[model samples]
Target: MLLLFLSVLLTLIYCSHGDLIADTCRKTQYPLICISTLRSNPHSRSADVKGLVRFILKAALGKANTILNLANDLLKKTKDPILRQSLDTCISVYQDALDEIPIAIENVGKNNVEASDNASATFVDADTCEESFSNSPFAADNKAVKQLAVVAEDIIGSLG
Candidate 1:
C-alpha cells in the first residue's frame, strides 16, 4: 500500500505543466496531485474554479474506472469463491464512486458546491470494499485498489 501511494505520489510531484494549476491547487490538501493531474490536461490552462473541480473529479473518476478494470480482470482469472465475492463487492463500490463523480461535476456546474462536496465525501464504499477482504492472498490487489481509491478521495477532499 505504501509502495503504491509513493508511486502515485511521484506521478503527482512531477510532470506538472501550467503554473496556474500549481497556484490554484495550493489551497488543496493534495496540491501536487491536483497540479499534476490538472496541468497535464490541454484544457486546464484556462480553466476556472468550477473547471478545476470538474477536472479533479474526472481524475478521480479515471482512477475508479481503473479499479473497476483491475477487479474485472481479477474476477475473470479467479476461481476462488471468496476472492470472487470480494472482487464483486469492489466492482460495485467502484461503480458507485464512478457514478458520484459525474453527479459532482453536475453539482459544481449548478453552483451547488455543498452538494458536490457531499457527493465527493461519499467514498466510504471503497473503504468498505477494502475491509471486506482480511489477510487473504488477494490482499495485494485490495491494497492497490484502496490506494487508487485514496487518490480519488484525496482529489475530492482537496476540492476546497
Candidate 2:
C-alpha cells in the first residue's frame, strides 16, 4: 500500500504543471495552440523549449522590476545635469523591459493554463509573441514616472 501511495503521489506531481498567471491568457486562443502542440508531439523537443522560454520570460520580468526601482531612485535625489541624462537613458531601457514583462508573463501563464486544461492530451505548439516582445527595444521615459508632479513639471521645463 505504501508503494502504491508513493506511485500515486509521484504521478500527481508529474501531472501538475503549476500555476497560471491570469484568467485572460488562460482563456485565449494562443494557449489553446500550446495545448495542442503539447498533446500531439509529446516526444518532440518543443516541450523543453516552451519551458525554457517561460523561465526566460520570468527572469526578464524580475530584471525589469529591479532596474525600474533603481531608475526611480536615481531620478529622485540627484540634481546633477549629466547624471540626470544618464539616468534618463537607463530609465528608458528599464521601462522598455517593464512594458514587455506583462505580456511575457501572460504567455507563460497561458501556456501552463493550456497544458493544465489538456492533461490527458499529448502536445501543443507554443506561442512566440511574448518571447518577441522580450527582445524589443527599451523605452526611457520612465524616469518621469517616478518624479513628483512639481519635479516632473520642472523637468518638462528643462526639456522645453
Candidate 3:
C-alpha cells in the first residue's frame, strides 16, 4: 500500500508540473524547443515563469560560450584571410553574447523586465555572428547559436 501511494503521489506531481511546463512553453514561438529544453532540466518541475526565464538564459550563456570557443578554434586552424576576417567578426559578436547572457540571467533572477531586452540583444549578437559566416565553413555552429538565442528571447518575451 505504501508503494502504491508513493507511485500515485509522484504521478500527481508530474502531471501538475507537466501541465505548467506545457502551458508555459506554448507561449514561446518555438514551443517544441521550449518544452523539450525545460523538461530536460530537472529544476523546471518546480520553477515559476521567472525561474524558467533564468533557466533559458543560463542555457543561452552556455551555448554562447561554446560558439565562442568554436570560433576561436577555427580561427587558429584556417589560413584564408576572408575566412579569418569572418571568424574574427564571429568571435567579437559571440563574446558580446557571452557578456549579455549573464546580465539577462541576473535580471531575470531579480524579476526585472529588462531581462527580455537583454535576451533580444543576445539574439542580435547571434544574428550578426551568423551573418558573418555567410560563406564560411562554420556557418552551422553560428546558426545553432542564433537559434538558441531566438529560443531564449521567445521564452523571455512570453513572460510579459
Q: Which numbered prediction scores highest in TM-score against the true structure?
A: 3
Name the candidate, 1 or 3, with the larger lDDT value.
3
TM-score for each predicted model, relative to the true structure: 0.67, 0.39, 0.85
List pairs with backbone clashes in candidate 3. Answer: none
Q: Please identify model 2 stretches exceeding 4 Å from their true place.
A: 1-5, 8-49, 107-160
What value does the lDDT take at residue 12 in candidate 1? 61
Q: What does candidate 3's lDDT look like per residue over 81-154, in tens digits?
A: 98899889878987888888888888774655677678888888877877776575556655555565666667
- Candidate 1 backbone collisions, by pair: none
Estimate the overall C-alpha local distance difference test score of candidate 2.
0.38
Which one is best on lDDT? 3
Which tens-of-lDDT digit does each residue in 33-62 have in candidate 2?
333333433342232434433433443345
Using lDDT as the yardstick, the better of models 1 and 2 is 1
Using TM-score as the measure, name the better of candidate 1 and candidate 2: 1
Candidate 1: which stretches are off by over 4 Å?
A: 1-19, 111-122, 135-160
